[model samples]
Target: MAAPSRNTCGTRERSILDRVPPLLTDLYQFTMAYAYWRAGRHQDSAVFELFFRENPFCGSFSLFAGLNDCLTFLRSFHFTDEDVVFLRSVLPPATDPAFFQFLRGLDCSGVTLHSVPEGTVVFAREPLMEVAGPLAVVQLLETSLLCLVNYASLVCSNAARFRLACGPRRKLLEMGLRRAQGPDGGLTASRYSYIGGFDLTSNVQAGLLFGVPVAGTMAHSYVTSFTSLEEVWPRTLVTVNQDHDPVDLISLTKGWLGRVCELLGAEPGKIHEGELAAFLSYAIAYPQNFLPVIDSYSVTCSGLLNFCAVALALCELGYRPMGVRLDSGDLCKQSVDVRGVLRLCSEHFSISAFDSLIIVGTNNISEQTMVELNTKENEIDVFGVGTHLVTCTKQPSLGCVYKLVEARGRPRMKISEDPEKSTVPGRKAVYRLVDADGHPFLDLLCLALESPPEAGRPLSCHPLGGGSTSLSVTPAQVICLRQEMFTKGQVTQPLSSAAETKAQVQDSLQSLHPRHKRLQEPDSYTVALSETLHTLVTDLRRASTNKSNVVLAN
Candidate 1:
């Protein structure tokens, strides 16, 4: 294949700062934008916050992600000529020409955006993002913003759980491609995995689109294509290995190479168990020299011992076979004893095999077992995560919803029997209370300018030494959760690159406590009632509940 072009100069230098969103937004958003313009409420300043009432994956805290993407989407949001033309074609006969003309030049110019820079340990009801602008502008943004944030946050949180299980030592491969909901489903999962701390991904498209690292190895097809071990070794060495890796083990006898080869349906050789032991005795003699695959037979009883034989053979041959593989059977048990027998076999040959052999466990690994296996920290070196990792079959969605909180200077609320599902009234902002260490303790919601009582409350108190926790304000003491990302229907900020966005997510994961990162019952991040909002909630609750009671009483 020809190498991809490296054009130093190309088509028009793209406007990275003023990116526009695709025109295929939810129809309601456009209709609302048009209505606001028609009603002269297009420039009325308003505020709305984006938040969730429950954590995805049942975790206590969620790592913020997708802000970069959100910003990019905002910057690129506008109705193009093509969009206008298409609208003209699709509008009903009752549609007015003036409305279509207004939309022809329409773009996001009146909105101001603020967000809790992606990667904060946020909780339910804490505004992750805020959009204040003309009523129509804010309303139009609802669907797309929710669509981007909800799914990104969900996958980011799930990836964090996987990170907890693997820790810093184990490398992770995000294999969730085939099972993702749609193209964006898999695409977003790759982006989220990077933020949640995965090392690489198998999706080449995802890697290119998101700037994530890509990696893979020989699949089973390569193993089945060759006739003998000798042929396979010579072919691989000549085609892919020799120039890249030139070492002593690179030179081998054809006979020994043939003995090393084991293919599917190949007959077993006549070596006795003791002869097998003798061959492996010679195997571990060289270090960092060779690697052999051993899962062609029973991976437990005979597989473990056969691995020992290979190790011994390499030792006597003045080389160490790099590792063994377990492709079948209860991996949990095999992982435990493989370490034991490999140790015992190496010692018997007097080869001092500490850290000499690596064990690769592959096939059928799921999120559940991967979590459990990783916690144990055995001698397992790498995981060949295939089908399960690539296909995120369970909980493959982020149920993000967006509703109009206010319009035309009037407060609004969606009455729902499920209190947890109720929307708050009016425009608001979310603030966090910080401890002495400058870490956020809890998030409090309040009217845009109303300060909550706990904002300056001392976390801990002392009368004398000044060491007692006093309400201290540092330039770094409080982080403004929102920033201006758009204005006057135009994107004002530079679009976040995939790398920048991914880094933003990784940085956010650091602030969370360890227990709050688990996949099971995660420790909850605090979302609390502010004094004013608390009262408002109380009053609203009583009024609504009383109205229902009055109806019942009648």
Candidate 2:
């Protein structure tokens, strides 16, 4: 595929370029590119793999996201004239102008990308993506790829944890726009939150740009607009019968309001005028979907009773009230109390639909809050999570690193004092092994040149570092996790829609064993190397140690 010509760059390309300039990369990337150009090794074939060392949010798996954005960046990868001019002005005087020319002509056309499809469940040390191309070109992609993947994966994992805590039936909404790091961060959170199983978002721009479903309820300001019942309904009579049975109170109030309004020559069926006016106005706007925030003043005294009256009045007008939102107070106790009120109204008013009214809780909810709420008896049907879902408060970052694993068709590895920091060497393939019941038992990494794992064949799986322990398994199914995302610098696969990607996440999570999905001290999923790959890793570690020892002696 030919590089996108500067003159022919369209609106979409320009949008991508605006978001990710060629100079968006770290300065070291350009310096290394220049060094490669000076040494005439810029075109050397190299392979780099992107992976994380540990799961974020203390969870066993992460939901892969942002591959679409990474692909977009790669497809439009090239330095503009402005970028070239900036580079010339900033580099050392000893640097060559030809290096700028090389950068100006650079594109990812020579690169081949292999990646696990976005929304797949990824674990530590498994290659999430691989880039193969000319050395300098692939090197230039490191920082941007990491930037896109790390935060996206982190947010998605956090959202997934929220989803797990809420269970399958409850609604999860992402309301992190105001609390996100920035505008772009807010948009990213909305996108990945949907991919991680959130049902909706409260960001309008995110909904417009990324097609995430947008939803919201009235704010406290809406509730505070009216000063008194008379202002809401002039000449309308209102009464509260405290002595009536709690179950029969809503019916009696409805009757009293009707009789007073009739005697006063006013709106006969208009409910309690002040707070109910706000709800009535909102109902006029969204008749079929009327969910009003009720806790602006009080839950039991003002909010719940007022909402019940307005909701029942709307039901009489042939509109089904969606629910009420509890934004403050003891959410667990308040939601149950609010539900009891709705139940009483449903019984008295003969509105069966009132029983299905959703109680939405949006008071600084977090994953821990969800877990705790799950243990308590509460009636919260929907949860709107903001800061914690988007910011990943438990563990803010997913430590994904992109490293060169092969150069000139020879395997390379980075050895570190901390073994966990060491890079796995070579061009590799990842296969998910499934057992008889179709649950993934383990992920097996092997040399790309080796034969793929065959189902029903017994194989020895060894963990890295020559450990004595090994897992013997005969897989019922073999699934190759990575697909060619970009071949010869052009996209090889169609980008998946957000909905499709979300479905992928849901399916992958369902296939995983429940134990691995646990939020606390979850069972670890096995990620092992094939026997041949383990042997290769062992040899490479020994060679690296020996070389270090020799260097010390010298």
Candidate 3:
């Protein structure tokens, strides 16, 4: 656990942004950069906002993630010599050699990023990060910025949604690595899911890279690997006892096995011996962290009985078994049944620890399923989430678009046949208005030049205001969401670690109203434009349509 080192560029030594290079963008981006250069607009100053049209999973809120990586990318954004050579070869022979020189010299030294703190709860049509720089350089950044933010925000939002469904009492384990799209996707899911409130991850690499706690258990494959007791040769183990002797743990475990079967109404001869032996081997290997998948044979018939036997034996050796995982069947009923059995064993055997053995529910557990589970009584303590959390099957992608909003200090708008597709023009500043109770009541976006909102005053017309309704609330605190992150080829803002970001998410969630984060029929959080910005939009629309009475909002 050494302190992180910083390079001359001010980026951390081991960062996610190091994995991304300047060339990891679409060909159209390069083409557009070249066109901007060809038209003599390469250095024309432009402002672009990175935002999403809607929250993924139909949820009302999303956590702004991946900002750290974006800043790191800016810190090290320069084309390698090889990249410039390849671009020269790809372009037509008539292409100016000066373009390649420009490419080779390209870096984001002049770029400035203004963004909300990472892990802030964001809404639709609100800017998460704003980039201001030369049009060519900013255009070169569009694809990579969106690529880094979209899925990170989407999966983090998904994980937060699942957390809401499960309640705060249950522990969440990210087990989606095996079911993710690829290695990178899996690793991303692990990192963001933990930041989104997951307690642990099964990806060892994520643990190593992101400082996420890692854990695992014996899978069904391991349970079925043995067919007889003889397979478990050298069946002795050293315990915490100071006797310094290898006790025959297998023999001791077998003694308790018969007792467990008799109490659970299973014939010892008919019980799954291979499964029992596998459990013992796993226990011997990781006595302190033994949590086996107990549904491999039969939860109550053999799996539970064998696990209880091995667990009691471990207790005798002064080792505590972690618990068991329920991977199949009616999870609700089985979880309740398992808890009852544990209660009985704890009371009968005078081993009070058995009463609190963790019961983890797995196997296709969805958000809806969790909602149903919460309605009934169950003893499941942890959720081992897989495909749904990582793959984002409910809503796979977040449409975070990087769009030009202003150029050459003049505000611009993109009016469209679809209002949702239309762009909000200008360099905007974002604010969160908090009430006396410290809950943020609304989010306001205004032109950066307009006076910032005050603690007490009449706020102006809504950006979404097509009608006469206006917000006139006096806030206890008018908090600015924007902070300078990058300038002069360095990250100017202090960055937060994964643990710090996750704590921010927790705090932000608390500050948010519960209605906006509910599992079903969530209340929409307000994101409005200031009076000046609204007036500007109004004039822009009127001029575009040559009509006086038209409004700017849907």
Backbone clash pairs for candidate 3 read: 463-529
Question: What's each prediction's TM-score?
Answer: 0.74, 0.90, 0.95
For candidate 2, lDDT tens digit of each residue in 498-534? 6778888999999999899999999888899988888
lDDT of 3 at 415: 89
lDDT (Cα, tens digit) per residue for candidate 3, span 240-271:
67465988888999888877776777777667
Q: Among these predicted structures, which one has the highest lDDT?
A: 3
lDDT to native, each model: 0.58, 0.82, 0.86
Candidate with the greatest TM-score versus the true structure: 3
Q: On residues 1-554, what C-alpha lDDT tens digit does candidate 1 reach at each position?
A: 12112221111113222322555467767676667777787777666768877776656776677776676666556677777778777655566788777766555656678777776667775667777776766677787788778777777767766677666776777766766666667777776776676777877866555567785533333333433333322221211222444333323332333343331222345322332322232232323443444454354434444445444444545444667656676666777777876665545446775356777677677778887786664667666554554344456555656655666666656668776777766667666555565556555556666753344444322111112223323222445465566666555665554456556666656555555666777666655544455556557767888999999999
Clash number for candidate 1: 48
Candidate 1 regions off by >4 Å?
Answer: 1-21, 34-40, 229-327, 336-360, 374-377, 384-394, 436-439, 452-479, 488-507, 538-554
**For model 1, where is the 10-residue window of minimal lDDT?**
4-13
How many residue pairs clash in all the candidates, one count each?
48, 0, 1
In model 2, which regions exceed 4 Å deviation?
A: 1-17, 229-274, 465-468
Candidate 2 is scored at a TM of: 0.90
